[model samples]
Target chain A: MSNQILIPKLAIVGVGLIGGSLALALKAAGVVGEVVGIGRGLANLEKALELGVVDRITQDPAEGVADADLVLLATPVLTLTEMASRVLPHMKPGAVLTDGGSVKGSVARAIEPLVPEGVHFVPGHPIAGTEKSGAEAAFATLYHRRRCILTPTAQTDPEALRLVRRVWETAGCEVVEMDVEKHDRILGAISHLPHMVAYSLVNAVSSYDRYEENILEYSAGGFRDFTRIASSDPTMWRDIALTNRDALLEMIERFELSLAELKEDIRGEKKDRLYDFFLRSKQSRDAIL
Target chain B: MSNQILIPKLAIVGVGLIGGSLALALKAAGVVGEVVGIGRGLANLEKALELGVVDRITQDPAEGVADADLVLLATPVLTLTEMASRVLPHMKPGAVLTDGGSVKGSVARAIEPLVPEGVHFVPGHPIAGTEKSGAEAAFATLYHRRRCILTPTAQTDPEALRLVRRVWETAGCEVVEMDVEKHDRILGAISHLPHMVAYSLVNAVSSYDRYEENILEYSAGGFRDFTRIASSDPTMWRDIALTNRDALLEMIERFELSLAELKEDIRGEKKDRLYDFFLRSKQSRDAIL
Candidate 1:
């Protein structure tokens, strides 16, 4: 734990899963003095207040971050620019503004210029989530043993970055840093593309003419995992796809070409080749484990 | 629980994960008096005996099932026919024989006629396993809270089917009965096709010229699950693919069509169509959960 509480007045915009969880973790560690939960929905804001995820609630970002030292934009990627624009004018001179967007490049580009001269704007993404969402689904352990990547530009203030890193480190996250563009491409290959594939696989199964209903009953190990991924929040994933369109499209092409090769091998009954390829995949998977 | 210990002498032909787990579960339940594990490797056999997965070990199938009331053929799908032929002649009168292979239709056809007049040959598959293999990787709880599918043809003896069902039930499995062809078709859509897609996805990433090493590092949520499936037993999957080639090939073709549709949607910037499709997938996946 740090020597003292770093965030005396922490303002959490869009107090959903990520926001609520960060507040809970910091509060549990006694590192956050006051958490002000801000959201468009009054019901969810009330829930966050009742659950002690925040000490206060606000309907507007402008009012929420008025006196806060750190303001975190934890809403959808599409809304970050507007949220940041509203909060920046009300924020104190030396306040830090960060985000927890899944895709950072677009968010960073949209909000970086809006951040006041003295205020620090660091775009971050915590690589942790369940299929569940909203404040009720959040917990202090959501970010425990997970990674939180902060994409800082050349103009980023050192103290701002350090403060954000300390916040994540105290939450039990391994902080990673990368250029925004590289983060997009890397996440395109791993996170975004895989989500697309999973959704497509489920769609593909549903389009089957003859054996639709029987498929789920026979689903044991492999198909079950696919469904679990495919069941993730669709709107959130759609926004991610659209925001990171180019890198996603490129990764999709790469994936399809690889898929074609395996299809060819299977159709041609190249047993030895198929075995070798499958073995290589197994080895790659083992490497990760 | 079955009031009486059903099997006095149980012989398992291949002492691998599924077979070893079944032996351990039955022995722990006090349902089997003697367990004879038959395998080609002396080292594995010794480990199985030491682990008490079996009471004794034998290299010869004839010697293994000589005095057994129940015999389980838990070998590869491709080896079922030969293994059955080897053990059938030596099986005791009124003994029951079953298998724990993934693909049932081919194995059922291959070994059905080899069953003696009074013997039962039930083709079964327990839908539970980790990527880890061999006797040491097995546990008594492997089959707990899992489904065991048994396919019995018209020629199958009633008592043999009952005894096999009882064995799986005693091991804390929910025993399900399906026709042999139906099992293959359903498994083709759900199990075999998913494995192929996962392997293809992994191979696709590896083929990327610019992003091979960076790809694995960025792997999160969905990618991790895909790699886990891709890491499964290669030879076993290869055998399932070959033995159930017709169904696997058909399902693969079905999956390719679905993938092609999604690819077109993404290329054309069909956001609404993609969203609706993704939503449908989420709904389908939720249905399974």
Candidate 2:
């Protein structure tokens, strides 16, 4: 172990809320030697710089990674594979590359082939975000007290993996390392399936004939909670659902089965059964809290 | 209009969160000459009095309503109808009696035959509560800025309805008057259906093989919100789902259709369709906020 902190010059691709927040955290912790932000739009890149998230901005991937020791791919899942390939040639020979994509299996497979020799590639998912998006929503403490799961393949370098773990730990995150397939499966149950259910719930109420307006008007009670989940970025969620299709579909089937059982109890006027289910479910929630 | 401020001696049955909170609000606003709490157990009644939520406590509903000018039936939905009959004979002539049951249609129908001719019956549902229950959870400002819907049948006296509205208004609730059927339907959509979904979602996740333990660990992202909703009183929610069966079943059917559409989009790998659905749902949530 080095006595001096390993301050890597980092390039953050797609400086949105997650990317920009990572840049800010890295700078705040003095773990990065220089932070450069790259994005498709110049205005977003300039805004990132103005917010002091990054030291510099570049439009060219090659130029952005010219002196970088670590590359953080923080784009949407749909763009991660393409962007990973585009930035591969520019990355330093021994530099470590990682991503912030929610779905890992597809992203890991897509980026694995594109990485050059001697460079380590790790896929990671930071399980934290608010309903808000964009660089304006970026904050240095966004990942604090949250879990960031790193899915490193068998080919990943031990030293490079240790450096990535140190980066997330400096941001005050609990780092959990897992295989890529397990990461996707667990996330589908906790994150991806919930998003799909919330979106469907909103669509269900909105499509009703006369109750649509009233539902929205009186949503403060319980419906509003689902709405907050449903209000996440559409493209991001769409990409997640499509990318993790099998696991999400399986969870949806489980949900439907439970829903059908509840509907039957309601129809049969089985108050005792409904009460038992509610009690068990409430106990589960308490256990979680 | 009475210039005397119409400070009625009030009786609140089943003085838990809703009933106890109402008693506090009535006393704070000086709208009640005396407030007496009636409960099945002596402990809750004594606790309500000790907490200053009620001026006195009574184990007998008949004894509690003997001299009261206004009586509030604040028991569970299943018990409210039977309890209404038991207390009506003891209620003073020219007194106004109302309830805080969530399902208005069943309660109104059940209580209609038991009401005496001289007394006025106005069924009301105060759409205010915390996850916490019992007298200890009661707060003076719980109903402030919250909506309280009154569902009065055609037989309900206009003067009695006016008095009930005035009481809730003094308690700082925006009062909305609607028919019993419409109130039940609307509440089924916003409150009942959401609770069912939350309970089912939790149950579905619990069915997974020990993965539920991990799901709870990482629930803060989105699933925790649903769990909180699921943690509501089991007896109360069970009665709600069973009583409001038609509307809940209808909502569930609509939800299943929407879920099927989402599943199809995921299965077909149609990102555009999924994105559009998420976008529309997000807009609805923003509109609600």
Candidate 3:
């Protein structure tokens, strides 16, 4: 790799788990000329610096991205649009601007109009995370062996797309490209629907008047697995649920149909139907592993 | 413990994962005078003897339990009632009979009438298992640090209950006693309901046509967690759902209500409501950990 392309100066906003981890990975690979961290909270910025995730901390997004060759918007999806608008004015001419947002369609719409004529914008989502959040929870290896999806609009610059792909690839993620709308629908089926199921499963057990004691005692049975997914960041998930409402509703409708069929099998004591579903589902999991 | 009490002659029916595991643990602990394994299949019997899970193998339940002081019914729930009935007439008069069934209420009712006057019948469930099944999957440490619930009827002998508890405790489980009805309800809420939800979630994604490929590719986002649970033994789970129909149905109703509320929140774009539910659910997970 050319030194100029390898050691590009980068600015990361939010400086939380995703952003902090990106900085650490870039620095560890010796691909970062300088990593400027920006966040609303001073404590988080300080923590990122102490963890060696970033070379400098800045409260102002403009100052953070002032001279950077690439700027990554790593804030919550709810704030990504506004944050992109705020930082667009300060980005260096021809610098590529990208985001790490869960949902890409709305984000692409939100940032496209605000970007300077010379700057390129790409929307990306790294399909990896933990139940815990914050800068302290980040590590250099967070993105290793994970998948990162990049969604670029028709007008997106090819060079900008390549640069973003290279960044994630160098961070040890397998990079794939797809259309924004298609990405949203796919993520809704695989990610959003599962989270909804987990949250609902927890709510079902908690709703029972006398279940609290027994639930805690016998949780090892199976409920504990759902709880781990249900324990994800509340604000992030809430934003996802609202933003991907159409796809989520459609998925939920299909889920209800399946649930009803299962209930019928149980009600009618149809062991064969239950057995077939269970065995088939297990094969899918085995394929994944 | 006295040698007579600690090393009682044992007979294990079915000789699959649970049965083989029990025999292995007993032998490892030197807590059994001898272990006689009984199953319908000659192959399984040969495998059990080859693996040393049992000291001897027998095809006849009558001959297997004839000389044993402790008989363990570790077969599937569908076969428990019939097998117990078959072996009851041949079991020693003072022998203790117990089962490892997921649902307790039905098992207790099925075997209660068939048990002999002097022989003790205690229905139990060890809340421990892996996705894998069969004798090949058996391990002596299967029940280590796991919870085992013994659901004995009021007529169960005190001495028999004590001996049953001691056996499970020796196998490295925390033993608790509960009414058969309560055990069924509790297990339904925690284990049965969660498994059903996981199956529903997987089916939901599998039904989507447009984005199926993408969904499978990005399953690591969160969907993969549910797949592992959904991949459990189909025959065993189907039996559980059918035998515990009432309790499972009650839980399904509660889950649907909760899910509908969540759907409404998403459709209405109620961020705060979704956030609050996620936060509350996350708190419960933290408590579990």
Candidate 4:
């Protein structure tokens, strides 16, 4: 409790994996006094409550955030604006409001205008996750040793940004601040584009399942590693693909160009070029690993 | 040693990860009386001898294969034909020869003609590996619970095929036989295409490294998993690509078409189509997981 960020009441809209994990981490750290889980699904809310992810569960957003000191919207990027509008007016004045959406620019732009005069809106993205989803998959250490990106604009209040940063830091995140546009572009290259490629690769291999043998059945360590991200939530990825369409499209184009080069080298039997392509990629990936 | 397939002497050429692991496994199982390690690199061969993966080390293919009961050519696919030609004449009349190349169709076609009149040749691929290479990365348990595909033709001796299957089975592999052409096509869809996608992904993300921030520095679990196979041996992958060019090219084309559909759905903001695209891929990947 010595280094905890004090929040008398915390309200989390869309208390699934991200929200449930935040609630559990804060409670385990003895920071927040009480957490209210809000979502459209009653079954998920009940499960969150039973798992000690939240102190209370509510279907109504207004009732959930009525007296809350801090509010977090941890839903799909497309749904954030609607959810924020529902909870912002009911939140206590001088309270800090934040989000855990993957795409920051559009979500921040859409939700920034709807924020009340007194309540502060700070946009954030935690670069940590598995290919799993739902409240049952939530864990207290999901944020440990991970990076949490916060995109704040000129309109963002200093105290509110500090509080949001403290919360993420308390949950075991190394917090970093960056421009929303840069965040979107970088994430598009690293995260969104990979998801698209993984999904496409899986579909491509499964297309051959109509033959006598299921190609997927012969998948070894390499194919399984590639398919791990392909098994992520469909709705979540669909929303991501739409919200960050422009940046994601640019990244997909770049990736296709890179892939095309290798394809041509393979087709032409250019062993030297193929070796260089693979060697360069290995060097790049090893630098990061 | 009762259940072991005993060989008076086993000669392994190109004793890197695959070759070294086979030697170590057979030695540990007490199936072979002696193992001679032959390779282009003296350092690696000495390491293999030091690690007890082989009882003898030699740079001469003829000296290594002289009087051997079995010979395993475990080099890259492209080099298999030349290596086979080098050792085939020196191998004993009743000796069985096999290979551990990823691509089978072209390699089998190219090497089968060079086989000596009295010796047997069986093309094989073990569906197992780490992103590591060299004799130092070899281990006895590398083939445990893994699938090893053997492609034997009309000209192959049944006794030779049985001996090769027993060797892999003793190394804890589930042996399956298939046509060389079918093996290449299926491995093209499963392994080769995935490696291409992963290497391209790593290259695309690293393209941003020319900028201020290294995008790869922020790679999380998903990106790391996707890059695991990208870090595999460049020479080995290059050989596989050139040797299996036609099937790999076809698979890449199919993957591009599949990716294009997802790109269009995202570009047009077709939410339902995007959802269905992801949903289908998720279901396919999840089925195998």
Task: Identify the candidate with maximal DockQ.
Answer: 4
RMSD, model 2, all Cα superposed? Answer: 2.2
lDDT per residue for candidate 3 within A1-289, as digits (tens), equals 2234564689999888788888888877778898899899999889889888888999999888888999898888899988898899988888988988898888898789888899999889998887778899888888999999999888899999999999998888999899988989888888888888888888778667664473665778456765688888898899899888898898899899989988988888887888887777777666776
The TM-scores that each candidate's chain B achieves against the reference are 0.96, 0.95, 0.95, 0.97
For B16-60, candidate 4 gives per-residue lDDT tens digits of 889989888888888899899999989998988998889999999
Task: Give me the runs in candidate 3 sitting further than 4 Å from their true place.
Answer: A1-7, A211-214, B1-5, B212-214
Q: Which regions of candidate 2 fall more than 4 Å away from where they truly are?
A: A1-5, A211-214, B1-5, B210-213
Query: Residue A71: error of model 3 in Å?
Result: 1.3
Chain A vs. true chain A, TM-score per model, equals 0.96, 0.95, 0.95, 0.98
Error of 3 at A9 (Å): 1.4
> Which candidate comes out best when scored by TM-score?
4
User: Residue B166 of model 3: what lDDT?
Assistant: 90
Per-residue alpha-carbon lDDT of candidate 1 for residues B1-289, written as tens digits (9 for 90 to 100):
5546789999998899999999999988889989999998999999999988899999999999998999988877778899899999999888988999999888888888778887778889988887778889779988888899999898887888898998999998999998988889877877777888888777766555564354676566657876688888888887887888888888877777777777777777687887787789999888877
Candidate models: Cα lDDT each: 0.84, 0.85, 0.85, 0.90
What is the clash count of model 1? Answer: 0
Across A1-289, the per-residue lDDT of candidate 4 in tens digits comes to 3445588899999888898889888988889998999999999988898988999999999999999999999988889999999999888889889999999999989998999888899999999988888789889999999999999998899899999999998888899999999999999988999999999999998987536867788877778877899999998999999999999999999999999999888878888999999999999988878
TM-score for each of the candidates? 0.95, 0.96, 0.96, 0.98
Per-residue lDDT of candidate 2, residues A188-272 (tens digit): 8777887888888888887666743545686555677656888889988988998889989998999999999999999999878
When sorted by DockQ, best at the front, the candidate numbers are: 4, 2, 3, 1
Instruction: Specify the poorest-scoring 10-residue window by lDDT in model 4 chain B.
Output: B1-10
| TM-score evaluated only on chain B, model 3 | 0.95
Q: Write the per-residue lDDT of candidate 2 for residues B131-169, one digit (tens) a residue.
A: 777888899998898899998788989999999999888
